[model samples]
Target chain A: MNQKTALHAFDQAVALESVGTDTFCGRSPEAYANMVGPYGGIIAATLLNAALQHDERQGDPISMTVNFAGPVTDGGYQVVASARRTNRSTQHWFIELSQQGVVAATATVLLAVRRDTWGDTEVSMPHVPPFESIDRLDIGRYLTWVKNYDFRVVQGHFDPGGAIEDTGDSLTRLWVKDLPRRPLDYLSLMAISDCFFPRIFVRKQQRMPVGTVSLTTYFHADRDSLARQGDRPLLAEAHAQRYSQGYFDHTGKLWGEDGELLATTHQMVYFKD
Target chain B: MNQKTALHAFDQAVALESVGTDTFCGRSPEAYANMVGPYGGIIAATLLNAALQHDERQGDPISMTVNFAGPVTDGGYQVVASARRTNRSTQHWFIELSQQGVVAATATVLLAVRRDTWGDTEVSMPHVPPFESIDRLDIGRYLTWVKNYDFRVVQGHFDPGGAIEDTGDSLTRLWVKDLPRRPLDYLSLMAISDCFFPRIFVRKQQRMPVGTVSLTTYFHADRDSLARQGDRPLLAEAHAQRYSQGYFDHTGKLWGEDGELLATTHQMVYFKD
Candidate 1:
């Protein structure tokens, strides 16, 4: 297929076919495959998409929490999204993603109709050079999903050798966008929230087995604001708080090119030392 | 009832009676009442207690996310806790709370058997005066639930008149413990994770109609460590990130008296101007 006619890899990966009422079928594409299964970001986005495409969906997503119950195998999977409760301005959803009749992931999404209100951003965006000023770090050698995004690291680049000897913090600030530059939307924004390398790898200075147990993202920007962002690279930063008892959690923030806070995300991850 | 014979208010509030396999009956106690409903913290703890009391519970709680679907009335309720998936060392649960046949809240909890590992706390505990040195703040006149916890504010005390005109940040640092000094456990820890007053009250300096849409807490301390804390006050701190589009989010941390990081929580709330 010609470049213009070809579908974006992300769209293909998260695409779902409606099979029944409030139910959809999806598949894990090879393009976004990780070492074991698929990239978690794609799985999270796919789950959110199930609710976003629901016939009874009321408003834009405000908050979503996706729990990785188990490893999703490479094959066909089914998503069941149900609106457990609906109010005048808000709706609550319970979504489940299963493969071969076994539950793999579950998510709870909160959608609401937001209005203009007295607004403020307490946290300021980090100071970083323009996206064009930094060189793109090629990480496609390690993970196939990394090839789908263009990453310009401003700090906390994953260095195996230097990380062990140097006592540096686990803070990664980067400029990233889709490989072919897709427009900024809730789906893409959801995927970008998990695009950061596991903070343990950067903190311990060594590659270890890590999996996100649960992830929560809150959208601050509305539909119109996100659409105005276009395909610009968002300024993203993440940092870890505590690593104990074989678990750690990190909080992240994403900003538009004009420094508008788009979304904030948090996740608890399990790691093997 | 005598003091020794009487059950603690918190214990009575979160008490549940098993009805069937994985189903339990609970109630909204008048002691823990909020302005509109029971405190969100008590509801979250009650849900966690269901899983903890389940027969199939595998390990301690690592993380939990509770979404408030609707206003729970002041009366009896039912909770259904299901182990959606169980792995060797990890288990996932989906819990639902209903009142009069309508779902009022839902939660997803992750439990795992954690082993000793290399540990570190990236974020340092904020320096504050000892709990004994700070003066106690009595706020029971505004909300009934405030009577359950003894609070000592070190900074960011809620002031209506001063907050309206003074331009300051929304950061609350306090030392708090159960009013009757109960032992610290997973259930009480979960409840304490959400005891902070709404960050907006501190930010906007005015009490508006605000509700928590979703709450997530990650526990870093193990059962032994929490048991060691026994009836001691925890140094808690909370701060907001962004407030826009009729929504806001806050990140909080709770540390033990010995500076051991215990839990980290994040919540997204809905607010009216």
Candidate 2:
């Protein structure tokens, strides 16, 4: 029964709008704009959609940590989301967002109830080259949040259009989704774990002022493996482990087009030339 | 002047004790015991030493996330740590840690001020084979927090004691520090980023029922590279991406001894049989 229409602009930029008990609100529609606001993975999937429309949510979202701390001014804000510690199989959240009253972003989810234990992965899952052999990143006509998802890359290149090489390492790897397709829930895997690109623009070779101050995903699929990934296209990779002083520390993972391992993000960005 | 005796027991097990104005009061030191609480890296270095004795702390700690949310009963414990957003080059905290009043644990630091621009370190730092030719983890007389650090491994092996093999991945790497030594700061680099050893006991060998429910460090060195790493041994590694339905996600890094890149953790554990 998926029918919201007008191509679900990311379920209308992470819907929200509850307004009171534990607050909610969210806004920001120029179809996911971003260069300063809106689109830190739809503000971390609208603060995990205010803890997935909390009625004291308690099960699925194994971990999250946002903290963009400021910037997000394309209209309303508010959020809140509390559940501070429930325990039985686990639950704990904090969530903030604020605007006219200040705060501007902060999260800390944890929900749980997952069980059937004893599994394992231990990294390893980077072997791209499908997704119709690459070629989609038309930089979304100059980055308006890259036209709300649908990347493709398969390897580094945040702008390998003209000049800029030295890719010494901050890998990329892509293949995302939600551009006209919208199904893999948990708010589009928390906005594709903040859509990569900004490990100092895939490790030096130009591109100054960056952002992402703090993010941390973790999820690892559930909700029936995200409704058996209805919207497909997942892959993802990302790298970076220290860009020093002006900060840097990405680390993505995503996967799941059979390979599974749904999420593992991490961020700390904040660059400058 | 480093004199606190008993080799300062990991700096009095992450001292804290201020007691007011943004709270403080830590405790836990049965030499850092675990199996339930007290050594989640000394409760994440006493919540990053309550945001480093917040006087509105302003720089360093480039990211933190904590969130153990339950089990921390070894003694006193009250942390608070606020400064929600101080900006002007980053600063945002919101710790928790309670006890008799509940809460248990929660963090979110960010602090900044760093600058010196254009740096790099895209991962690669697992050369190992040094720390005086390995061999040191005696499992610390049955785990009282592995006798407070001094690990050494050089490659995977949480207990490879015998028939377990299958180490195809959950890599570990080691060479840690602080066993009667004490100079590096930022609360012993946030207690050596939770010291390692639980990538499901270094991949599938055995040792079920794990814990760590949420953690996320970032730090990338500063404070004169942690006072020139004065206590020595740093190199770390850690791995893990999916452990499935009962949580699991690691991602470590640490390094130093010239190769730099100081901190970059990430966690979300909680395993079972």
Candidate 3:
């Protein structure tokens, strides 16, 4: 779909009667490219949108788990969501995504309320270069689209490397924000989130895209902090659970404009080495 | 390890830990397994454990996302979990897994409180066979050695297929219980939560193993719900998300006696058809 079309569709999807988390499961057309090939992140995030709408126990709707069911064939599909329990301490929902009349993906979502206390702030955040110290690497694809973001190296090259604790001390710290001309939004949150791949591969010179196996994300904080980035980007860090059998799971922490963290996620992905 | 020794260690681990969401960053021998061949359900439960310990806002924790990280290997590892925002309308956390001093896996978790109202309930739980009607299908390599317990699928068949969801139905309600029978604990919850693959192929005569790529789980209630009767089992209904590119994500929901919704999970898995 074209930009305007995609945007219109996104808006429609967001407003659809069946789109919200509290509603029954319904698949968005944006979940697919053609039909069979699923847009991994989009499908997963859309599911998140479906569950958070009803999560009552969670102080915030911040985390989700999804399973990729089929080839994401270019066929239209529907999403259905239900809950097993709505306990006051926790609310859990079960969702099934069907494509071509078959279950394509299923997920369970957990959300919790926030308890803010100036707890023991003993564990210090990782140290990395300042956002302004480095020149942003452009590896084609989405370079112009990324001018609004910023990052610092904490580990690997800023490319998608799904390797867990490699032998090297490769790490990255990114500060992401939109250009003054364009502000940020939920889609922007996902857009910057989509950029974590390169930031994860900081030690490398080339960019590698991995077909993620699964993704778990938490959006616990507000985006206001990101709005204050000025010329800087958000600070983000990612780590691989491990790399074995051609698949890997990685988790990341996305810090808001302040030193406080905004969101976090763990992703299982497959990469072509 | 001897049962006494293992039990002692487990108790110590549970004790050394105060229930802080940050402390939920689970680092343990089990954490190592996620790095190298850890079963998907186990990984999901571990991630949930941490999210529960940390969440401050969203009432309780709801929702989870598990994407494939690496091939399951054999090794012991540790996990460190911390909340991105512990006091939000909902809560989120960042967890990192390390094996042999290397980061092995990472997870993002969301927590929400529970609410039961017409505006909140959108979907109904799927149907599975009665826990008493089905038999246990021994699938796991370690299942033979009852890790202080034994669980039987009273709803679905122990065989691979015959009335299974695709062939059976959308549910599998099984009766699971600890062998020696102790108070409900996290280990028992972890051990029993794994039911998707074997249950799927159970209706058939053939035995097929679904090697999981990744797993994410959400706990709606508390650990007490897992205390199933030794005579009856939990009924679980599971279905494949889809299977192609030689990979797919599958999911299952477990219900206890009196049809109480216990827990749910999504497994990113690969099954050799």
Candidate 4:
């Protein structure tokens, strides 16, 4: 295994600099830059990281909703993560990302100490070829964030610079993992949850003015399960239900090697045709 | 026409007594009580209502996520809704529901002035029997919240007091509308998004302790479309992907009489086996 994993860079990017009580500063690295702002996934992971590293944090994150209210300036930003309510088993947190004294993005996260209980998977994993059967897609020139991950598209391919294929469906499935290879954790899982390509690009076969307005993710697996997935690619599927009235909704699910559901996520993206 | 709609009681229950700037007090009515606390839908709607009536609120609700940190008290509670970021076209608000001095629930809402653009629904509406064709599930004695809405199950029925049928799948389809008749709006839509029975209760014959830890909703239709849907029953479908580790996730979609998609919602519920 060629094991020069980019985990170090990922960790440095999400590591927050503490400046005050419950306040931290972070910056998006050039390797994961988007068109106008930092990659949404990295930004999300950074915000969640702030809460995880906080002194008052109680448990693991079970649910998080991040709202992109405005453009995130490409430079350094400040995050304020405050635990809004703390119960015996669960806690709620409110987080904000600000630049130049202006709020750019806001988020809410629910953390809980999970307990063992009877559980089952109701949704079946889609039958797809093994990871070794798919060819890796070249996204090095597409966006800064795309280059940081190794992606093999198993279905619904969209060529950014080629002819548009109107598949009449907005479904994309891929196997993805950190480029250099890194152990899975809450931070990495949070980033991977937002790593899907824009559904508009897949449906329309071309890029439009689109940005994710809000994102919500629910984590299903625990730390041990994630660690067991060390450096292994995750199978992910995403599709949009509606693309209308200047917005669209995308739902996605990520699964580990054993078909264990790792996370389920949903986001609404604003777009202009 | 028996125009005495359940909306009156809903409105009264959500109506807040403004005590100070951006702060209000609300109470749960006995008409919508659940096993322990009031219905999660009512609490969500009440939080959204506080932001809607706020002077600083901008545009309509595009996305809202309410986090149920702890059980809400039986009687009165205070809410503080503040606009965290106000852009030209979009605004983000953070809200908290508290009793005495302890925080009970928290929420985040994104409001936006939607623009006219090309839109389409990819998820086809589930073909179910007409609202009038299916007998309404008589849940009047099950919980107070059941009496607040008229629900007709079209698929995946479970007897609360009978032996459990372990269906391999956890899909549920139903037709539902507010009791009596009330015009469709954001508040009603918010409540309706959360009106689904717990997936555990639907999948298992008996109701184990279950509560929604967090809920998120994305609005697809605009005010004009919602106005056209006024008081009509909506075809709704909800299903779970996994139920494990003391928690499960459910996704739902609501459609109008004309098959127009109205909203998409997702929630994570805590359950004990």
Candidate 5:
């Protein structure tokens, strides 16, 4: 197919085929592969896509929590999106992704029909240089998934040769957008929420075994706002609060070019020393 | 029952009786009633309690996301806790609370066996006066659930007669603990995570229709550390990031008396003007 008629890598990676009932069939595309398995962000987007494509879906997703239970092999899997309860204005969903009859990941999604109301933003976006003013750090050679996004770091970039004593704070601020230029949407926004590298690598200047245990994202922007965002880069900022008992948790915020807060995400990560 | 023999109000509220293989029965006690229904915190704690009390449970909860699907009536409900996947070090749970076969709330819990590792707390506890120095704000007459906790507000107290022009920022820092002095535990900590009043009320300083759509909590402390806390008050701080489309999301941090970060919580709230 011609480049103009071809599907974007992200679209292919998250593409799902309806099978039977509320189940769908999906595959982990090679374009978004990570060091161990598929990039987690793509997996998250795929699980959310299941609900978004379900026939019984009620409204837009306001909250989603995904638990990475086991490693997802690079192959096909089945996703079951079950709408457990549907209220007048809200709906609750229980979703599971299974491979060979064994569950690999699960998610809980909250969908609601939102209306315009009194609105305010208490947290302001961080001031940073334009995306063009920053330099993109190319680490795609190490992790294939890094090639999917163009990252312009303002702070907290990893120093491969630096020692522990030279490490800095866990704060990471950057401007990021899809490499092939995909417009912003709930699915893409969900994927971008997990795009931040594990905070431990930036804080200690050392890479250890770490994976996200549970991730929760709250969507602040609706469809119109997200569509207006277009393919422009988003200002993303994240930081860790506490690292204890072999675990660490970080919170992040994503903002539109016009300073609109798009989403706020939180994750609990498991780390091995 | 005598005072010494009776269960604490919190314990009684969270008490569960096994019904079936993976199901249990619970209640929404009057002690934790809110303006419209039961307190969201107790509902969350009770849901987590179902998993904690399960026979196949492993480790402690590292993350939990509770979706308040429908109004939970002030009566008995059945909770079904299903362990979807149990890996060597981590376990994933899907829990649901239903009354008369109708689902009311659902939760996804991540439990893991945590070990000691190199740790640090990037976010420090805010410097505030001791709990004894701040006068407690009593609003138990309006919301019965408020009486279940001792709230010593450091700032952002509601002014029942104040105008919107005199409203302050959407930040609330207070020291809170269960009433009647109950020791701290995972169950109690889960409930306290949602103890803060809605941020919209603090920002607008007006009483409006509002309810939490989803709540998530990340536990940073273990059983031992929680035991050491022993009924001491915890410094709780929460603030909103954005309020739009009839929904607002907030993040909170809970610190022990010694300034150790205990838990971090987030919630998405729905409001009607």
Candidate 6:
């Protein structure tokens, strides 16, 4: 069986355009549908992948920031990337996600040369529970139009319907490795990052499905520990930020295997209940 | 003496040009300087404060996400915002940051009603080095342009002066908090998030004074802790995402006395140095 079965290109506005290389759209029907907008890690990861496609780019990416400038529509948009600066071990680029012919979001990436993998090869794995050990919840149980990403919570979950505010600080440790290991591209990671709400938020308040949004993430390190392994839990956390009118920002972190810092992400999620 | 205090009027944007709630030419420079972008958390937080100016938005915003659609430029851009959807205890919004006449970024926000707060919370705090006890370093010695915010490393000064072959996945923990307690607003927090970068990447990459280009964050919960003094250290994890392109993201968690999780954050940062 093929690992990633292919269909025609995505017909969604953004995802379809991503295949063209002119843009990177987070048209993933993952967990919350357009529910939470695009995942920040997806933005971080996708921008990096797109940057790699450029030959003029040098070094490895070590840092990136996705400023969720504004809402990027579910409809396709354009991305323009350019090297802002380049150094021996680090390279910087300014990337913009635009819709039609306008700018929707902006991001920057810092690529650094991978000094051949060296030193005492020790990684402190996270202490959270394993992915498969956690419970799985179907997003469809809630949002009818929302497609669900098969996700398990190693540290926390609100599925199976439970009382909330029974916990503290709204903290959670999770294992997040996507099903059908598709190389865990940053784009896909970002897409998946948009899947869930912090169990803390959902529990204490009304549940809201999310939609069209922008995101940004910082990739901590390559966490292939959950690679290809089905039933692994990807630990994640979504925190609340200041809100006004109808907007606010949130951040999440994903972990895999022995407590290793897998990925740190942020999303400009849009909430709809 | 105070330099200049800013005001964000929603009279025109919020009441008149409803969609133009978060655009430039309509925002004060102080507000503009603080946002990750036009509709970013920095400003959204300010907007949230304003949203509650009227009692309707108050009930305790459990969570909120903002969706951005157009480019909101500092010098010459327009911005807009909308509600993704709202039900019972939660609300969502769509924001567009426009520049010239194009949509640059989009964002979405989710807000929920908080009926209660976690009291006398008992939870083990994450293992973080004591920031105050650790000999701090003046980051300007290494990263000269940190004039935006004060950055202190609780432990080592992670800087890659020469060639480095990554031994394997590496991580370093740092204690970072804002300098001098000023009014904690969205822009201020947004600026603080910009300061997160793992020493690991700084130790291996090329150089320059880097700023947060794209920032995505997840907030776990709202807090009254802000009313208290901020001598606490925020634990930060900044590390690489992938080696080939040098992408990276960081996580930050803020806790209050008694070990309550006040906030958790993740950001995708673009490093130039």
* lDDT tens digits by residue: candidate 5, B241-268: 8999889999999999999899999999
RMSD of each: 1.7, 21.1, 22.0, 2.8, 1.8, 9.9
Give the TM-scores of the predictions, in the order they appear.
0.97, 0.34, 0.43, 0.96, 0.97, 0.51
Residue B67 in model 4: lDDT: 92
lDDT of 6 by residue, A70-98 (tens): 44456445566666455455555666666
- All candidates in order of lDDT, best leading: 1, 5, 4, 2, 3, 6
lDDT of 6 at B137: 53
Instruction: Give fnat, all candidates.
Output: 0.85, 0.83, 0.02, 0.92, 0.97, 0.10
lDDT (0-100) at residue B170 of candidate 4? 69
lDDT of 1 by residue, B9-116 (tens): 999999999999989999997888886899999999999999999999999999999999999898899999999999999999999999988999999999999998
List the candidate 4 regions with Cα displacement exceeding 4 Å: A1-7, B1-7
Report lDDT (Cα) of residue B229, candidate 2.
77
Task: Report how far residue B211 has shifted in candidate 1, in Å.
Answer: 0.4
- Compared with the true structure, what per-residue lDDT tens digits does model 4 show for residues A1-273? 334353477887788988999899988677788877888888889999999999999989899999988878767999999998888888899999999998988899989999999888887788999888988888754887788888988887778876667899989999999877888899989999998889988988888888898999999989888888888999999999998778899999999977889999999998989
Tens-digit lDDT track of model 3 for B19-76: 3434432333342242236545555556556555543434443445543333434543
lDDT (Cα, tens digit) per residue for candidate 3, span A104-186: 55565654433332111111356666667766655243433343344444455544334443334334455555444334444
Name the best candidate (by DockQ).
5
Candidate 5 lDDT tens digits, A195-216: 8889998898877898988999
Instruction: For model 1, state the Cα shift of residue B7 in Å.
Output: 1.2
- TM-score of structure candidate 6: 0.51
For this target, which candidate reaches the highest lDDT against the unseen true structure? 1
Q: Put down candidate 2 lDDT per residue, A1-273, tens digits, no spaces.
A: 456565477777778878689998877766788877777888888888888778888788888889898888888778888988898889889888888888978888888889787676766677778887888888644568778677888777767454667768878888888777778988789888889878776566566678898999989888888888788899988788778768788888888787888898988888778
DockQ of each: 0.86, 0.30, 0.03, 0.83, 0.87, 0.10
Clashes of each: 0, 0, 162, 2, 0, 134
